[model samples]
Target: MKKFALIFVVVLSLVLVGCGANSDKASNEKKEEAKTITFQSEDGKIEVPAKPKRVVVLSSYTGDLINLGVNIVGADSWSFDNANFKDALKDAKEVSEEDVEGIIALKPDLIIGSSTMKNKDKLKKVAPVVTFTYNKLNYLDQHIAVGKAVNKEKEATEWANDFEKRAEEAGNEIKAKIGENASVSVAESYDKQMYVFGDNWGRGTEVLYQAMKLKMPDSVKNSALEAGYYAISPEELGNYTGDYLVLSRQSSGDNSFMKTTAYQDIPAVKNNRVLEVESSKFYFNDATTLEYQLKTFEDFFLGK
Candidate 1:
């Protein structure tokens, strides 16, 4: 009787343990159901979380995510280097374009960047990587695409609308102040090489030509618009230089271009219509940089 009673107790104990284990498994399954989802991605039909909690952005669009109010866990060095994004990305880990091990270590739910990333295939083993054609779309469209990829298309649309409205207002103000007919040109110098930009390039061309509705020089339009940008020798810079000039400097490099007889002879340079902005600050087409671009124009054009 004693042996039989001990056997019964042991069986009852085993049954309770099994029930507890089943309950825990159900709870875990529910939690997982709440967290993950299979969604579409740029690289064909890839599975991703419906709403990613841990995002690793391996591109320059980190500011676009910040504008959408998303939490980021990892990013490339460019995101950390932006002065406006430094504080927000301070705690974020850095992952390189080729760093599959580093990216996997972060255990990110979503990864986003340009399609040109060399290790994109390898990175896929770690997480769903969404790729965008770099510089293929306009800034607003780029943001919208990113938003859709992250399941935040509505938020991105609202932001894009607000940005357009603000840009139009600012453009009107600038046009009113600077005159309707004034032509603006965007030019950048890197390592003593000069290039004229179209409206879509990151170097203030968007604000100067597209947002503000400013006119581009005929020479610039003819030369740079088709290719989106055109390289020009400093001696021939006068052709592309318009009434208002935006000069972007990547490094201190030979600023002798500014003192060149060809450069100084331009009417904009003579009239002090040149706005000098840092290349790092102006080389991005994201929301943060756009805001900075607008503010700079307002201050300069409004004479504030």
Candidate 2:
């Protein structure tokens, strides 16, 4: 009787061990099943991680990703320059398309970049890659598209709706103060050339024209409306100055031309209607940037 009992006990122990092994295998399979999702890119559909823990952004969409609450492991150099992104990106490493080995070391789960990038083939080997055509979707749609990629569409939509309402109300109040026909122009001075922007270009152009429904100066419309921006000489700057001018220039840039008679004599300059913004701060059209633009315009127009 004792010998028979020992054999039965051994058999029961083996059965229990096998059950535990099967359970662990099943758990691992479930994790693999939940790993990825199908993302529709501008080019075509591709499989991407459903919940990307580490994302590397290679273009100007850094601010868009920041607002969507993605964990950025690596980003382009330009992202670091954004005032709004300073705190959020403090821990992130600066990387570009040129840094393939560096990006590999970071082990990003996903990558986002512009369609114009040249290293798509190499990046795909490291992880899933998705690219967006700039302005292919309008500024608001672009944010929504980003949310979709990161599984935060609802949050993105909510923010977009709120911004629209706030911008509309602000626009009405600003129009009342500045008059309906008062025009607004956004101009930027770079190293050697000056650029005038239209409704879609950054530098608060979207908030000023697209969201706030502000008027664009005819000279700006003719030169920059279709092309987004027009490069012109410094002497031509006065022609583009509207009743209100939003000027974007580097903080330490040479702006001595502002003292010249040609620049001072512009109607807007004479009236002190130019609102100077740091070029790097106003160069992007992302949620963080749009918020800054909205507040800046509100202060400039209504003194609020």
lDDT of each: 0.83, 0.90
lDDT of 2 by residue, 2-97 (tens): 999999999999999999999999999887768788888887998888788899999888888888889999999888888789988988999999
In model 1, which residue pairs have backbone atoms overlapping below 3 Å?
none
Of the candidates shown, which would achieve the greatest TM-score relative to the real structure?
A: 2
TM-score of each: 0.84, 0.88
Worst 10 residues of 1 by lDDT: 34-43
Give each prediction's root-mean-square deviation over alpha carbons. Answer: 8.3, 6.4
How far off is residue 136 in model 1, in Å?
Answer: 3.3
* Model 1 CA lDDT for position 103: 80
Candidate 1 segments exceeding 4 Å error: 1-34, 37-39
RMSD of 2: 6.4
